[model samples]
Target: MLNIKNLYASVQGNQILKGVSLAVNAGEVHAIMGPNGSGKSTLSRVVTGHPQYTVDGGVLEYDIGGQMTNIIGKEPDERAREGIFLAFQYPVEIPGVPASEFLRASYNAVGRHHGLEEMDPIDFDVFVREKMKVLEMDDKYLDRALNVDFSGGEKKRNEILQMAVLNPRLALLDETDSGLDIDSMKIVAHGVNTLRSKRNAMIVITHYQRLLNFIKPDFVHILYQGKIIKSGGPDLALKVEDKGYDWLIK
Candidate 1:
């Protein structure tokens, strides 16, 4: 449902992504594994239209309503409205914004953009409660400040909770496994897998195979120096876990 062709992106003055390209089909999960500085995060951020990232060349075409449109010229919020979601590795804590309040506003905004009816406070609360149940997240979390004073795992779970609620066409999970303990990792992964379907796609950018074990991807891509250097099935994850990316260093 999404395709990026010869995409080049840079930050400040340094170019990170160099002619990267990939295609993601609905109902398929893709894993992008790479060493640091290979532009993995850069790719995700650029695809999401982060203001800090500048597209130097190439086209980022997104399929919406069966029509392909170039998205390199769109803003981050515009990209989100077009059905792209990016779950941050480190969720920023808005000190005073309550989680429930933020979520309701976000959900309502997306609904309004799609010309759908916006949920009132009560309806939105009920909707969020249902999603929280699916994610197995505690209702008490809704009373707390958004990510403020939350544990690393709690922050990550909260992100997944947002994903389950919004149901984006494509979700870009950037290092969702970082800083998570075994139990937390599995919980988060389960949440992601449960939300996957014939109409949604996921691009999981990770550094470890443990996350892949839980949410097995249809394609595993090894990104080196801003390009996809290798692709295979699940066995590549096993090999990387065994080999430690040493051979891919060159």
Candidate 2:
């Protein structure tokens, strides 16, 4: 579970997120919707502790063993190790490192953080292959360089693949629906739904309600001008689709 209170974050010298507050409990999916420059992506980066962003005010906390652990100054890697996962809006391409090698290294790192043994190469292949099934991915994908030369859909699906393997308690998907076709969106959404459960939560940052049709978030929030202005159920998304952010902004 994650709780943020009046969080203000800045990139370079310009402040982006101002007075943002949100709480994601276990098993709940919260969809954050807003127009460009509303700080939806900023919220994701701040939550994941991106280096460019500085938290100037308020508290960011994560629950560990029933205690509210302050995560404001935590390093990005520390947040990842503490079970925070962020699916970037645009996944970067690593040209040389094979996906399998990169994924295995990341998986092992998280495993070590949780006091679990690292799997050997052969064992990791078997373990990752099982997870790949959830995403309907091919074994050939593992041999390719991470996101290198992958289509937009492939990169998005690859992010979900990482999420499935990492099994984080809190997953922040930053516009995962961008650049994806309807079929690809459905596939990616299916993968996300498969991973949902009582032990984990997701914060979906998106621009359109189409993704909502598939994932069906438990709560919908309209984030405008760096603050969450309205919160409602799934019907809120349908209203956004019908009336647009202009209505909400007004």
Candidate 3:
């Protein structure tokens, strides 16, 4: 489970997240929905230790393997190594590094954190290929530079590929459905739905209920002005889609 308390975070002197709090239990999928500039993305970055956003107040804690750790104080890499995974809204590109090499390095480093030995090169190749296949990615993608020239949907699929490989305790997805067409979205959603289990939890951050239509969440949360304004089951998403965000502002 994860616990966040009264989190006040800022970026470049502007307070983005003011008094945000939420909890996600294991095996539960919680969807965070909000209009742009509502600090939905900021909440994910602050929890995962993005340095650009300073945590001015409150605690971001994670209970991993039954140990409570305050992740706000940890570095981004350190937090990643500690079973917290963020499937970025926009995955960055590194032109020189091949996708396979980047994943191997990341997977090995994270594996070490769990006291697992690194995978041999051959083992890694097979492992990555299988996961990529689940994402419907071709083998040729492994040879390409990480996210280099990848389409928006491709980038999103690649993000889930990391989540599949890392198998972290907590997965934070920020607007993962953006730019993905329905077919591509289904592939990504199926990958996520298949991965849900008691040992892991997911927070799907999105603007619409379309993605939720594919992977049903245990709870739905509406975020407005950096705080959780309302929560309900799937019906909340239906109401939002029927009424749109216009009603919420009023």
Candidate 4:
């Protein structure tokens, strides 16, 4: 579970997130929808301890296994090791690293942090191949360099694959639907849906409601001008899709 209160954040010298407060509990999915420059992505980065965003004031806390811990000063890797996952809006390519090698290294690193046994190559291949079935991914992808020359859909599916493998406690998806075709969107959504469980929470940040059609959120939030202005149920997304943020912003 995560709790944020009156959070303010800035990049460089300009303030972005102003007085943003939200709570997410286990077994719930929250969708954050907003127009351009509304600090939607900033909120996700701030939560995951992105170095560029500074927490100017207020509280950002995470209750990991019944203990309330403040993440204000935590490093990004620290937060990630603590079970926080952020799927970037635009995944970057690591030109030389093969996807399989990268995934195995990442999985083993996280495993060591959580005191879980590391998987050997054979075991990891079987493990990852099984999870690949959820996303309909083929083994050919594993042999390619990470995200290099991958289509938009392939990159998005790759992010979902990473998520499925990590199985974090809280997942923040920043525009996972962007630039994805219908088939790709469904594949990504299916991977997310398959990963959903009562013990994990998801915060989906999107501009349109179409992605929500695939992954139903328990709560829908409208974030505008660096703060969350309105919060409602799934119907809220439909309203935004129909009337635009103008109806809610005004």
Candidate 5:
């Protein structure tokens, strides 16, 4: 559903992603593993049309209604409306906005884009509660300011909750496993796995393989020096876990 070709990107005039390429089809889960500074997070930002990162060269395309269209110049909201979702490594806190209010606004915006009717607060509460169930979240989360004082695990689960509500066709999870304990990671992974379907795809970016153990990627890739240098099956992650990136880098 997504295809990238030799993408070259830079942030603040310093190049980060150099000649990186990958293709992800519908229903597939791909895990990207690399050490720090390997451009793992940069790839996700570039794909999501982050304003700070400029794409200097190559093509970035996505299947918009079954046709691969170049999305380099598209605005971030435009890309989001096209079913691209990014789960940030560090979810920002919105001090005054209730989480439910924020979620409903986003859900309604995406729904309106697809010619669907918006739900009233009462109706949306019912709708979002079901999604919250998938993440095992309580109703209290709805009243809190978005991530205002949430713990690391709570923030991560909230991100998955957003993903469930938006139901994006292409989900880019940037370091979802970061700052999460094993139990918390498992819970977050359960929420992610529940959302997996034939009509959607996920690109999981991380520095370790433990996250893969729960998410169970269909493919594993080693990203190094801003390029995907190795690709293999699930065993590739096992190898990385056993030997680390040093072996792959060498």
Candidate 6:
């Protein structure tokens, strides 16, 4: 559902992603693992059309109906409307906006894009609650300002909750396991696994294999020096876990 070809991107004039390429099809989960500053997070941000990163070369394409269309110039919102979702490493706090209010606004915006009718607050509350159930979240979260004073684990779970609500066709989870404990990671993984379907795909980026133990990606890739240097089955992550990147880097 998504294809990135030899993508070269830079931030603040310093190149980060150099000649990176990968293809992800529907129903497949791919895990990207690499050392720090190896362009793992850069790939996610570039794919999501982050304004700070400029794509200097190569094609960014997505299946926008049934055809692979180049999306390099598309705005971030345009990409989001096209079923591209990014779960941030650090979810920012919005002090005044209730989580429910924020979620409903996003849901309605995406719904409107697809010619669907917007749900009223009462109706949306019912819909969002069901999604919250998938994450085992309580109703109190709905009233709190988005991520305001939420614990690290709560913030991570909230990111997964947003993914459930948006139901994006291509989900890019950037270090979702960051700052999460084992139990919390399992809960977040459960919510992610529940959302897996034949109509959607996911690219999970992380620095460790423990997250893969819960999420269980079908494919594992080793990204190094701004490029994907190795690709294999789930065992690849195990190899990385057993032996550090230096073995592969050598």
Number of colliding residue pairs in model 5:
0
Q: Which stretches of candidate 2 lie over 4 Å from their true place?
A: none
lDDT per residue (tens digit) for residues 1-250 in model 3: 7898888999999998888888888889999998888899999999898879999998788996688778777888887887789999989989999999999999999988889999998999999888888889977999999999999999999999999988888999999999999999999998888788998899999999999999898888888887787888889888988998778766
Per-prediction TM-score to the true structure, in the order listed: 0.97, 0.98, 0.97, 0.98, 0.98, 0.98
Q: Which candidate should be chosen as best, given lDDT against the real structure?
A: 4
Once model 6 is optimally superposed onto the true structure by TM-score, how far is the C-alpha of residue 12 displaced, in angstroms?
Answer: 0.2
Alpha carbon deviation, residue 79, candidate 3 (Å): 1.3
Cα displacement (Å) at residue 114, model 1: 1.5
lDDT scores of the candidates, listed in order: 0.90, 0.92, 0.89, 0.94, 0.93, 0.93
Model 4, range 1-250, lDDT digits (tens) per residue?
8999999999998899999999999989999999999999999999999898899998999986689889899999888888899998999899999999999998988899989999999999999999998898877999999999998888989999999999999999999999998988988998999989999999999999999999999999999999999999999999999999998777
- What digit string (tens of lDDT, one per residue) describes model 5 on residues 79-197? 99889999999999999999988999999998899999998999989988988887878779999999999998899999999999899999999999999989889889999999999
**Candidate 6 lDDT by residue in tens digits, 1-250:** 9999999999999999899889999999999999999999899989989899999999889999899999987899889988999999999999999998899999999989999999999998998898888787877999999999999999999999999989999999999999998888999999999999999999999988999999989999999999999999999999999998998898
Alpha-carbon shift of residue 167 in model 1 (angstroms):
0.4
lDDT of 2 by residue, 74-154 (tens): 899999988999999999999999999999999999999889999999999999898888777877999999999998988
Model 5, C-alpha of 100: deviation from truth (Å)? 1.1
Q: Candidate 6: misplaced stretches above 4 Å? A: none
**Candidate 2 colliding pairs:** none
